[model samples]
Target chain A: MATIKVLAKCCGVSVATVSNILNNKPGASAKTRKLVLEMAEQLNYTPNIVAKNLKMQKTRSIGVIAEDMTIFSIPDIIDGITDYCQKQEYQILLTNLRLFKKYNDTYYNKDDYYELVRQEIKKLMEKQVEGIIYVAAHERVIRCIPDNLPIPAVMAYGYSKSRKIPSVVVDDVGGAAGIVKYLLDQGHKKVGVITGKTDSLHAQARLIGYQQVLYQNKILYDPGLVAEGDWTRESGYRCAGELLEKGVSAIFAMNDLMAGGVYDRVEELKQTIGEEISVAGYDDRELSGYYHPPLTTVSLPLHDIGYKASEWMIELLNGGELENAGENVCAVDCMLLIRKSVKDIT
Target chain B: MATIKVLAKCCGVSVATVSNILNNKPGASAKTRKLVLEMAEQLNYTPNIVAKNLKMQKTRSIGVIAEDMTIFSIPDIIDGITDYCQKQEYQILLTNLRLFKKYNDTYYNKDDYYELVRQEIKKLMEKQVEGIIYVAAHERVIRCIPDNLPIPAVMAYGYSKSRKIPSVVVDDVGGAAGIVKYLLDQGHKKVGVITGKTDSLHAQARLIGYQQVLYQNKILYDPGLVAEGDWTRESGYRCAGELLEKGVSAIFAMNDLMAGGVYDRVEELKQTIGEEISVAGYDDRELSGYYHPPLTTVSLPLHDIGYKASEWMIELLNGGELENAGENVCAVDCMLLIRKSVKDIT
Candidate 1:
């Protein structure tokens, strides 16, 4: 309940001096600053942030609208954003759309989704957020960016079709290629692939990476070696069974969950992972390291992407242009985590 | 940039009329209100929230400081909180502490943790958040609540030891007891227990519930049937193997993840899950229903707890007392989700 006037009176200093010391503004002597701070602490003076924000015409806050909070990967990305914001002395206004529930609802449509997102954006704007960050739960393209938002906007884990707005995304194609090249270098000639939905951009890109590696190595691109999965453990289990029937020496599941399913199937067949057959996965999730024999996987640098996205938004807010940032899209590199899942055939 | 003055001039009305219509104050005429709204929409008038907040002396914003974001359950709790806040017309300022990383660091101690939390609380207070909701990633007792916080603080999924502040927590003991009674009524006498760390309060509470059910059923309590796990799938697998050696007819793992491990071990032993051994787990996590036999588990009502916590905080913010809320702790009941994991063993 103590105000600056009370603290100033208690410290035997003028109110302006106390205010300068509290706000870290110039004109307060070091001795005055020390005395004021000590007295303020003693009196438990709380600064009036609402008045300060009004005077500054900015809240020192940004809004983050996440597509869904339940997705496993989204939290880590948020963690990265929070870390950056904390260090930069900015707060976050978060809105979780719970898009999964909306997507599952029969009555929900694209128009409704857009309307809901626009409402959230308007709400944040009304709160005087300096910038906005849209985070996608999955790796996909966002077709719309709400043309002409007054505040600077950045996209994380997804991109806009027009590429006018800045975005930070994972280099899925490069990551897949790196993993396949590692496998091929280890002499995995008959490597089978368990892919996610064929329609997915990430799945297509990963498949392309697989084929590129095989083409460069002069190995025959066998359509029979690829099996489709819908990114579930059951699908991976079934798909791995089909792949094993073809007598493939090694396998690559597009995700760690599918890789886990493949591990289960291999164990069921009395085969030891990393010994009788080699396996690798993507998205080095928490369970990947604990999987039997652990998992050789590619780590999606989602946290880095989130951090970079926040940095870019802050830059944009400070009147800096993002035009030189190469196509308005920054692709963060993925890390190859070489665990015990993959064996060296040589 | 369109202010109420511009809208008032365009609408041929006074600035007070425009302001009343905008704020939904009762003084504006119905005709003037309609005209002002139409002209405001046509002019794309966006209210200056900073100025409005300064005038009202309240921001209508709440701060949610999550202990850690990466924990699976925390997001759901946040989702619940967001849902309620949205309905109540409140905005949220979120801060994820990433305490898991700090907890794992050898240099981090209790003092550092408290100081970090205190700083976050100060940050939120400085932003003039009307109320504060401190969300813990896990269910545990918070030793300190930082005495004399300016804003009303509520604990979600955790409680302060002093009980001066209101908290919403899951009834873990009641949940465990309910599940055990359900199993016992199905004629299962020898129910093996896979518990978390013995030091955990939840683990101890669940064990007590198990013993209470056994005592009520006139069955002898056997320490040999209980196996210790560290709340991980690996630990569950190892502990289930030990429990199976004791020839128990049914098993109850402390969590769905551990139950999943038990299912895998059961399948590895060439035994049917629901028929050969009935299984039940707690915390009906996403993957529990997708497990081979579809785990029958107790659902922790985290969302309800979050909703209740927010409602209580809002009540306190409205100058309503939570005096009737016994010991400032509201324990929400957990529901038992009946699934295929538990067989009716008559």
Candidate 2:
């Protein structure tokens, strides 16, 4: 409850010196800064952000509207957003729509959900949030944010498809190419692909990555090697059976869940994952590490996407030019997690 | 941005009528109310909650300090908090202290981390949040929240151990007892137990639950059958081998990750789970469903804990008495998810 003057007097320093330390301005000596901060902590001094922000018309707060918190990718992304915001000393006003809990995976395509989002945005705007970040559960071209929004908006893990509202998403094409290249490097000539829903942006981009790697390696592209999956374990199992029967030396299931399915099918066929047929997966989910031989997969840069989105949101708030890797969309790269699943045939 | 007056004028209604409808008060004709609301929405009218709240000296916002968003338990708990807050028309000012990311698992016992929590709470208080809700990553006796806080503080998934601060935690004892009782009812006389780290409150409570069920069934408790596991899959595997060798018909691993280890050992020994050995798990994690025959586990009421914490926090804000199911603690019950992992040996 102590003011700057009281904290400074208690610490035997000038009020300006104490102010510099509290504001993290680089004017105070290290020893003096430590003394002032420790004293401030002891006195329970908290700057009234609400009163200050009201006068300045700057809340130093970002409104983060997550599609669903319970989803696998959302937490990590939110973590990234928080990490960035913490460094900037900005607080987040979180609006969890709980879409999955209410609609059970069917809410993503619903027009009514947009109305819910609009209402949340208005509520946040009423609270004087400087900007908004819409965190989607997955990658998709979701046009949820209205074009005429007063504040700057950034989309994480989904495309806004507008120049004004930038998007930060995973580089699925590059990630898929890297895994397929790794499989090819392991002396596998025939590598079968098990994809997520064909209409999915992730699936399409990953397929392109696969094709790019094959092209660079001077291998002819075979559409027959590709199997359509609805991003389910059962679908992966069915696809794995067909791929194995076709005599492919290795298989690449788009996600970790599907890779798990491939493992199940391989086990039923009385063959080990790494020995009989090399396998790879995408999305380094926690369960992937528990997979028998473990899964060689790509770890989605979900956190980076969130961080990037925050960066863009703040940049826009400050009237800075938006930095985008491609046409106002930033594609964060995924990391390759090498485990025991991929066999070195050569 | 149309004001209430402008909206009312556009809808051919009085300002009082518009204000009443907006505040959810009755007496206005349904048709007139619909016209006013629709006109308001079309004009992108947003209420200035900040200015109004400043006058009332009450912000309909709760400060949610999550230990770590990336942790499995955190997102669902936050979701529950957000769900309750949304219903109450309250917003959450989130401060995710990336404890796990910063200090890994060791941060739980660090005294310095308490300072970080205190700082965050002070910041939230400065922002004029009505109350504070601390969401822990896992259940532990975390004494991070200050004993003498200005605002009401509620602990979710952890014990605050303060009479003033109501703690909402999972009913580990009851959850453990329910699973053990199910195993006994299925004719498994020789049951084995794999416990988490001995010092954990959850592990200790669960052990007591196991003892209670055995006493209720008039079955003699065997100390030798209880194997110690550090809540790791490797520990689970090691304990499973020891318990199976001790001639136990069924094993209950304290967590799903440990239960997966039980399955690993069973497979290695060429014995099938749910048939040769009826296995059960606690913490019905998502990965449990992907287990060979899936897992019959106790689903921790993580969301329920968040919901209960929010209820108590808001109740306190409204000048209501603290309602704790136990002494300063409310233990939410865990749901038993019936899956194929548990078999009917009778």
Candidate 3:
């Protein structure tokens, strides 16, 4: 925080002499330069970029504030963001909030967290970043980005709730529908479903997708076949038995972690998945491939969501209108990975 | 690159008027301020921070160069870096090289990658970061950081091969020895070894650790009991059968992925993992916990390595001598996680 004048006074040298040495300009002898340099360090003479408040302009750098780097969804989203930004020769000034590590999953529910985000935003603004991108660990209605922010801001993997900040999230409805359609096509009329936590938007949308597929097929949707799960492998295992007792030929789990539970239940019943009973899961986690039969699942468009978020940011920076101005949200489609877990009974 | 003079000329205003308008200082009329701002934006005016090169001092920011964020090791490392930095109130300017995505695993073996790193370094230097921390995806003798660099640089999860640039890496030797010692204490004689690729420093160090344990226990080392695995599950499976045939009671896999292969081979023989064949794995990956009986493995000190790397960087920045200045390479200890996979024969 010290100025060159202060450093000069302490070192018994002229301000111009201290400036010359600090700027690497010739004129000061090596001894004077070393003395001035050491003194400058001692005084913490930081020429802060906040000085740019006087004249800061296009930094060609986007400030990315991630909820937590340790979260599973964050890395891929960041990868996608960096991939696109690098292509545009735009630099990334990253700030990891470490919210999850500090507060666990309940951080978002806290009111003070939003204020924390605003602080990070203010710091990035001081650094003169052209735009801002907030990467969330989970998809939810996150109102962290202020509606009246001066610069452009985009949300990745979560809803911002404000029209000013565009949000990019996974198309959970389409993803579940696509996978369920494949399961029905495999000759499974009575397909059991393991739903995620009741409160999750993902769970609700995926259930709608399943109901829509059954409606189109003219099959009466059986509420009995839908067993509640909390998105854990144990919950999936607990729900699978009820569905199997209901005579469903195949089971669809909301996420791969729960699907692993279904496998555990099926194996316990002396039934092999993909043969006696087909299983399909959403979220093709890396562990899904290592599953005994390899799970047939949906891979969330996480990377694409990040890419789209940055695309919207760069567009806004370039003075272009957001592509999803009408809805203010972009839902990226998930890919159906047909591994060995789904059996073709037909 | 547009200067205030150019912006003022374009706005048809005096330089002071333009400066006052851009700096949000009162004096300029609203209409005049709007015109000046519009002209500044049009000129791609950025009050470039590089102008600080004239007198830039302590920015209290460190540049972190990550090889790839998509790698499993990177996020946690970055998390640790952020953890230490936030506590110290220092900012991080992150540059994700995305080397694994661009050049695959062979990037380290390539000649051009070093030049790519130097370019990134230059960009960070221009941003006036006081220090640099390079996070490598894999451990190796990396000479990417130049010795002539003015500011200090630290290597995380890899060796810099430079005394000036302190390196923080996993204590693979100690990690392996600790787990192997646990296995030996369980009354398991004739423990078989499955090593990673021969070229890896991690694999070599781990192998030495296994050997050290055997020698300390007064057990003769047998080359036949050691099987070469290229850090793949398939290779682990291939070697598991051979080690089992050689009549070893327990297997020490170099990594968890390879241990998963051992599980596969054990199941093929219609035997339960812990009951029939005890297994201890390295790098306690997330998937290892999901493995059937779970896995007993060594948890790498990735987060600690990152924390130590930043500690070294801050020390160098604060003019404090590095604690490990004598060795220049500080190998942080790994934690032993006991899960269901390893059985006590005693």
Order by TM-score, highest first: 1, 2, 3
In candidate 2, residue B82 scores what lDDT? 91
**Chain A of model 1, TM-score against the native?**
0.90
Once model 1 is optimally superposed onto the true structure by TM-score, how far is the C-alpha of residue B140 displaced, in angstroms? 1.7
Could you estimate the TM-score for every candidate?
0.92, 0.91, 0.85
Off by over 4 Å in 2: A1-45, B1-43
Candidates 1 and 3 compared by lDDT, better number: 3
Q: What's the lDDT for residue B126 in model 3?
A: 63
* Rank by lDDT (best first): 2, 3, 1
Clashing pairs for predicted structure model 3, backbone only: A57-B46, A57-B47, A58-B46
* Total clashing pairs for each candidate: 0, 0, 3
Per-residue lDDT of A1-346 in model 2, one digit per residue for the tens?
5566798899999988887888889988999988988888789887766766876878899999999999999999999999999899888999999998777789977888988998889889999898999999999987878978888899999999687789999999999999999999999999999999999999999999999999999999998899998889999999998898899999999998888889999999999999998899999988898888999999999999999999988888889997543588889999999999999988
TM-score of chain A of each: 0.90, 0.88, 0.84
lDDT of 3 by residue, A124-220 (tens): 7766688999999988888878887778999999988888889999999899999999999999999999999989889998999999999988889
Please identify which of the two predictions, 2 or 3, would achieve the higher DockQ against the true structure.
Answer: 2
Report lDDT (Cα) of residue A113, candidate 2: 90
Candidate 3 versus truth, CA RMSD in Å, comes to: 9.2
List lDDT for all candidates, in order.
Answer: 0.86, 0.90, 0.88
B218-286: candidate 2 lDDT, tens digit per residue = 999999999999999999999999999899999999999999999999999999998899899999888
